[model samples]
Target: MPAVDPRLLRYAKATRVFLALSVLIGAGQAVAILAQAWLLATIITDAFLHGAGLDDLSGQLALLAIALAGRALLAWVAEVIAHHASAAVKSELRMRLLHQVVRLGPRWLTGERSGELTTLATRGIDALDDYFARYLPQLVLVCFVPLIVAGRMFAADWLSATIVLVTLPLIPLFMILVGLTTKQLMARQWASLQLLAHHFLDVLSGLGTLKSFGRSRVQVATVEKLAAKQRKATLASLRIAFLSSLVLELLATLSVALVAVSVGLRLVDGRLDLQTALLVLILAPEAYLPLRLLGAHYHASAEGLGAAEQVFTVLDREIPATGTALLKANRTIELEHVMVASPDRDSPALDGLCLTIPPGRVTGVVGPSGSGKSTLLAVLLGFTRPDAGQVVVDGIDLATADLDDWRSQIAWLGQDPMLFAGTVFENIRLGRPAAAEFAVRRAAGAARVDVPLEQVIGERGNGLSAGQRRRVALARALLLDAPLLLLDEPTEGVDPDTEGELLNTLPAAFAGRTVVLVTHRPALLGLCDQVVELAPAAVAV
Candidate 1:
């Protein structure tokens, strides 16, 4: 929002090079502006004062044409460069922000609004087109153009140059004041817009539930209310933007008028020649053009700047620490006084609890709802960090072990197994991308995925039955053959026959592997080498 934000350069180094190129182009453009003004003035004075014919001024007119064409070409080039730089910066920022979010994991994101984040990554970032394509290029021009034009004016007419210099500061002075107000308004408008987007997405995702409960009309009213608030905030922000542009236009116009009056008066008294007076009049407007355009485009880009500020806030958050040590072959895991606090709850999810899972055996973790069952799994998977203790693997602190390395050794199946949009074979191969076709078919058979291996599944397994989707996820986990297997409610949605078949395969599938099984199903407990029961919070206390 200032002439330039430092974060822009910090996030996009290519922008610095782009700005440098813009400076060079702006300097060339300034020279073209000065030359075009001088040539036009020279030709006009020849025709009007000296009664020269068209032929007498032909050479100067030709030079004037070249200057005009050159200026237009330079302007076009500047725009193209700005667009390229903008695209590169937006891509880099989006990718980096996504990586940061993934590193932070679900525990940190539990309290965040998904729709708001999606809007920020998509529409919010797209708004920055104006900032890079229009405002940034003009910002460079403002620094170079005015000084170049004013310097030429001094050599031609010192008094006119003095007047120009005295009035130039007024444009930026008024711009800063209006820009401060506009920045606040733009930020508010963007925040309201994000809320509206979030509400709209939420309604769409839950439209089925709303209709079933006969609350669809009620939700429509809620959406309308949010839409109205967004509309009001947007209009208010636009009013300020228009008002600021009007003020800047008036100030620049008045400054040029003052310069014209002084030049005309000097010409009338025979103190200045027609050529010098015309040059001053022509160059005066050019001197103030960059600053005026900069102010106008600044308002247009305010929303993007505000969105960028929010992106920086997300990127600045702390992520769970990862280490470089490789997980060894012995897969015994120990939790030492582990404590994990829930985001919305008053007490810790897992409070000062300790457990040991021996190597090469299946362990069952049974607990009531909200008794830290899922939280314990999250900690084991390195998705959440313990507040007061550590997790050790083969006597090595997992906190100091490489997360990717440790996770590569694990195959996880959650209560609601996530199945993506892909062919059955493709989804299963996601666990190990280089898996053989034979291996995929074998894993699918083991999980009782009856569909053809090439059958396509819609987004979030929409086209498949709930039981089929769970089997696909199971096949994915089985295909990986990871040293550590973790299953949470593995047979939750399947039929009894399919569940029995899966239970039968578990023993062979988990043979000689360390496994942590979390389930309420008694059938699953029969296959565990050791069953650990987690008591309620009050009982644990």
Candidate 2:
């Protein structure tokens, strides 16, 4: 619901460049074609009709060859420019989409599915390739090439040009009419893909749970049903695309035949000169050729347009308020009547609750389930906003500073510590890319993640034990060396031994940093310098 960002209009640049190249190539192609007809007419009317023989024919053949080669070379050049330009545009678009997502931050992604997001980022953006490569490029040819060819036709003989122009609009007009149906089909196809992506990610994430409950077969059957629906939608879209192409081709073919017929009649009637009639007949098809190509590719581009519309929706979302002021010092964080609400605002979670924890101290937030312990940390990290009052640091309102700059002053371990598909070293190093090897090893030692750094974490850290994943996540936070550290239940799923070690090494691991931790565990509560409970909102969630 935010105002559309002007930055997204950058997609237009790629389209413009594509169209420009198309005009150049299309004109070059039209010239070669017109020359071919003129040369043929000269050979037929002058040489063949007169006493000229083999020698003259040989000279004309060489001229024709030169024209043919020129057209071929220009066509090849056009293709290269199109492909390279398309690739650059595709790369830039993907990077922009990713940057937009990151700027929007975790608040948006948490409610969305991973597979659907992946599909949007990967398959969705890929659809735009043909929009740039084929449709826009050929559309340029359709418009400009025809104009050039038609002008040459009128100069040669206005009657022939009139016949061709009368039928020319038939192709594009029919294409547009059929395109309405194709657009609807493409929309259905996109919806099917989104549903398929959501279903697959849900199934994969819950596979362990499904297997434990002996419900894997049910999920498999559900997937089969979804896949069948997707297949149906895909076929429907393709069928429409093919049918539309057929209609456009038919219209173009009819137009070309009409021009050929008129030229032939004029030649037979002796009303038109022989050479001019031959030229008109030959050049007529060239005028409509690019239109045919554009019509077909327009169907291909429809899917991309639909996908882009969906992507634009994300970019258009109002980036809800986040902190702007930098934390003045490392010693303290304060919240005054900070209330965290759902995006829907149907149920507010944390009420007008207030809290303060000093620097160099460990704090614990404990609450019954549905209490806003997690939301408190979220607001502090600027992932969510307080509905009523302000969250402040050293008298600077969190809402007044640049959010990303404010967040950099703190290292946070969320309830779910994200681990990519890489080695443990890379995962921990993600927090502090410039940290030296020795510094990294020491942090790992403090967090007790002593496993070999080269070991793979598997998909989502499945290769490691729960305690090991916890320790590795802790190592990432420690390696950051941030001024303020926020730990959201560092030991919730960890074992007692790992928990005891984390507790024992707590002071040294987090020495001199302001630490605010969220925990329901009694053992973790004892380690904090203070404990605060975020009371539930007046109305239950």
Candidate 3:
């Protein structure tokens, strides 16, 4: 990646504004640095060489104090801007990234790791703190202060300026060489972190299954191995950072010492005056300071740079086309020759399938594992688009219909429903947030949700049993009351008694909605007005 990506400016408006302010601040800081150096040099020369007393140097002393104060104030102001800019830029990038992900939809997200994306939005974006707070500000100064300091030095004394100009490039030249290696190390460390996050999340999500299979210990060992690899990569990056810092410091110190020696010799030989010599010596180090600081902070900012590249990759995905047509009520859903492919599967999920369901009726979809039952619902829900053929609703092509408007007509309940940490009422109200208490209670009663409304539940409904959670989710779906209801294996993982009770309630709860049910139970199929069985993706349906 380039030291600064132009996409950052394009994707985040705050970055553009920050850069503009940085330029103005940088110019002011450059002027302040020169004034302070010149005033300090004049004060020292006047006092030492001309035997100037306090009264004679009072005005110069006051001017020097003001210059020093201005430089410090500018530094503080730059710091404040850097922090604020860092926060604003990070927030902007994260929001853009999340919005882009949503635009790409669940189809695109299926291929990505949730943990990795979570890390990118949180820790990955956070890494930019060093980039904005320290590295970027110094980068602006490197553009302005160094050149200004060197120009003043050249006008005062050409020989000392020549030494500074010749040695200045050495610091950056070495920094570039070290940075190449550091970049590779940082990439490895970042990759390791992402892998660790992905694996850790997987372990947590499947911990119960691992324990049931007596393989939890195996997963623990695997996690330990990944953690160790991440640790090693991090240590390697730190080692390179420390080594580069040392190299930069040594080059800068030697360059400044060379200028000091040259200036001292010329002053002793009467080739240079005390004021000019003092100015040259003081300003020599100033020329090297920005470059050295930049090299040091580059390592600190590398992790954030790597993360930004990944975020941009996600942001660059092509969003599926949508349309402006509003979906009307009493519309029929028709799928003609639909085929959906999966990257990880050999065959398509839905292949050359044609189907239709009339408005306000329950349709049951039954199939074996790996068949297109769930894929059919995904097609109707607009989460997965067909590679060939079209899904039409009331003569409007779903591909051409506005997805938000289309989805507004849908109430979906997945086999594994997600529940946040909240009370029963809050979880049920998610389907229809504006629903009154009586309406909520009616839906819960229809769905057979016996839990108390004020009873608190853990995240993912951890406090409830599988059957209770499904009932809560069903209540949510019932509360939605959208025109279309899509339920995928709602009775899955429930006991036989609970499953029969749920089946008894579903038909009445599904009344007055265009319902598509994906399931394997014969009892549930009996409740549907029409039943369709899908074959494996290898064969046409």
The alpha-carbon RMSD values of the candidates against the true structure, listed in the order shown, are: 2.5, 3.1, 2.1
- Per-residue CA lDDT of model 3 for 32-58, tens digit only, reads 788888888888888887899999999
Model 2: CA > 4 A from native: 1-16, 57-62, 320-331, 450-452, 538-541
Q: Write the per-residue lDDT of candidate 1 for residues 1-541, one digit (tens) a residue.
A: 4568787788778789989999999989999999999998989899999998878888888899999999999999999999999999889888878987888887777778888899899888888899999998998999879988999999999888898899899888988888788887888788888888888888876777799999999999998998898899899988988888898889889988988888888789999999999999999999999998998898888888888888888887877668999986346799999998776567788998889999898899998988888888889889988998999988898899888888888889987676778898898898799988999988888888989978888766867887898888988988899888888887878888888998887788788888889989899899999998887654333
Ranking by lDDT: 3, 1, 2
User: Mind giving the per-residue lDDT tens digits that candidate 2 earns over 1-541?
Assistant: 0111244345435645666677878778878888887888878877746867868688887888888899889888887887887777677777877877887778778887778778888898888778766776676677678888899999999987997888888887787677777778888888888898899888887788899999999999989998999899889988888887887778778887888888888788988888888788788888888888887777777777787777877766788765445554385678888767766555677877788878788878888766777778888877777779997787778788787887788898988888888999998999788899998888888888868998987777877877788888989998999888999888867888878887888788778888888888898888888888766545434
C-alpha lDDT of candidate 1 relative to the true structure: 0.87
Estimate the TM-score for candidate 3. Answer: 0.95
Clashes within 3 Å, all models in order: 0, 6, 0
Say which prediction, candidate 1 or candidate 2, comes out ahead on lDDT.
1
| Model 2 error, position 291 (Å) | 1.4
Query: In angstroms, how far off is 312's CA in candidate 3?
Result: 1.2
Give lDDT for model 3: 0.87
